[model samples]
Target chain A: AQSVTQPDIHITVSEGASLELRCNYSYGATPYLFWYVQSPGQGLQLLLKYFSGDTLVQGIKGFEAEFKRSQSSFNLRKPSVHWSDAAEYFCAVGPSGGTYKYIFGTGTRLKVLA
Target chain B: DAMVIQNPRYQVTQFGKPVTLSCSQTLNHNVMYWYQQKSSQAPKLLFHYYDKDFNNEADTPDNFQSRRPNTSFCFLDIRSPGLGDAAMYLCATSRDQGGYTFGSGTRLTVV
Candidate 1:
């Protein structure tokens, strides 16, 4: 079965500092990868996705993620984080052939310090 | 904008009472999913409707039921509320191989 792992449970970063959240997955094929963000008391919002061509994908709110096939990692990065960017981050993997089901990782709680 | 919308941002029900949470979509996606998210946990798939074909997860209890009257609407029904069932119920929609659009979710409290 497919699964995802986010090694960090909590990360605190100063505002305007660079940030990276690590994610790794287990899948047989070239998996569909995605990053999502969830604020308190709110639903998830799509951050970015890696489908086929580009190894690096850009997403909403100045976020980007790089898909590294060899390492089975798709880590999220932001050059300058904002205070409002504090939230929970989730990494998910889905099958490529058209199944919409996704296996999500344990979330990483991000705390942006001023 | 095309989006998924869930009703009653928050709900409170007594023990053993029946409660229903509603979800509607304007995206016209064929797949609608229900997920249960407890505090500090990832969302767990409960069931989904693929254009009226219901698919339930093996571990999903019989106390939970769902209804999809049409492509635009889906409902999650809890037959008997329990303390353990108190969690955020999230509704989402997606096309095959496409990213999901999620609603704000309904927070349920079993009193």
Candidate 2:
């Protein structure tokens, strides 16, 4: 079974500071990776995804993630995070050959300090 | 813009009462999914409809059922609400594009 792990349960970062949220996955074959963000009292919104060719993928809200095959990791990063960016983040993995089932990480709570 | 839409942003029901949550999409995607998300937890897949075919997860309880009347609409029915079933119900639609578009979600409260 494919699974995802977000090592950090919570992370606090000052506004305008760079941020990184770590994610690792265990899968037998090449995987499709995704990052999603959920604000309080709201549903999840897709941040970014890595499908095939590009190891690095850019997403909405100035977020980017790099897929490292060797490490079985796809970590999300932003050069500068805004206060509005504070939310819970999830990392997910799906099988490569048209499998729609996605295994998600527990989540990482992001707090933005002014 | 094309998007997924879920109805009744919030719902309140008594324990053991039946409740239904609705979702509709304009994206015309072949897949629609229902997910249960408890407070601060990752969303768990309950079931999905691929076109007209229904697929339920192995662990999904029988108390939960779903209906996808057509490609544009899907409904999740909870036969008996439990305190543990109180959570956000999310609806999503996707294609082969590898990304899913999600609705704002319906937050359910069981009293």
Candidate 3:
């Protein structure tokens, strides 16, 4: 079974500080990794995805993620956090092939302090 | 911009009453999916339509059903409402092996 895990349930970061959200996935083969952000009462918005090629992938809102094959991790990062960056972040994994179903992590809620 | 659209941003329904949530996509994707997201939790897959074929998750309840009448529209129908069923229902669309485009979602409230 494919699964994604986000260890942090909540995180607090001051505005303009760097941010990192940890994510780990379990799958038999190379997985397609994705990061998504959701605001309160809103649908999820895709931040970035890792299909192949370079390990580091850039996404919207100045977010980026690096896929580490050895540790089975895909951590999301932002160089400078803003107030609007406060949201729930989810890591998801889909099979390299076959079904399109994506397995998502429980999510990590980030709070930004100005 | 082409995107997935879900109607009824919020819905209130009485217990045991039926409710339907609608989704439409302008991307003309081959797959349309429905997910149920509880408060502060990951979205759980309910079902999806690969074109006109419907696929249901193993753990999905029979009371929850879906219909994709065309390539651009899909509907999620709950036969009876329960307090536990209150959730943010999301609709998404995608081409084969492509990333998904999610709609704003419908927040279902059971009273």
Which candidate comes out best when scored by DockQ? Answer: 3
B1-111: candidate 1 lDDT, tens digit per residue:
989999999999999999999999999999999999999899999998888899888899999999999999999999999999999999999986687889999999999
lDDT of 3: 0.93
DockQ of 1: 0.83
DockQ values, each candidate: 0.83, 0.79, 0.84
For candidate 2 chain A, the 10 contiguous residues with the lowest summed lDDT are A95-104
Question: Which DockQ-derived CAPRI band holds candidate 3?
Answer: high
Candidate 2 lDDT, A8-101, residue by residue in tens? 9999999999999999999998888899999998888999888899899999999999999999999999999999999999998985235577
Ordering by DockQ: 3, 1, 2
Candidate number that wins on DockQ, 1 or 2:
1
Local distance difference test, each candidate: 0.93, 0.92, 0.93
Taking all chains together, the TM-score of candidate 3 against the true structure is 0.98
Off by over 4 Å in 2: A96-98
- Could you give candidate 3's per-residue lDDT for residues A3-113 as a string of tens digits? 889999999999999999999999998898889899999999999999999999999999999999999999999999999999999998995237888888999999999
Could you tell me which residue pairs clash in candidate 2?
A: none
TM-score of chain A of each: 0.95, 0.95, 0.96
Comparing only chain B with the true structure, the TM-scores of all models are 0.98, 0.97, 0.99
Question: Which consecutive 10 residues in model 3 chain A have the weakest lDDT in total?
Answer: A95-104
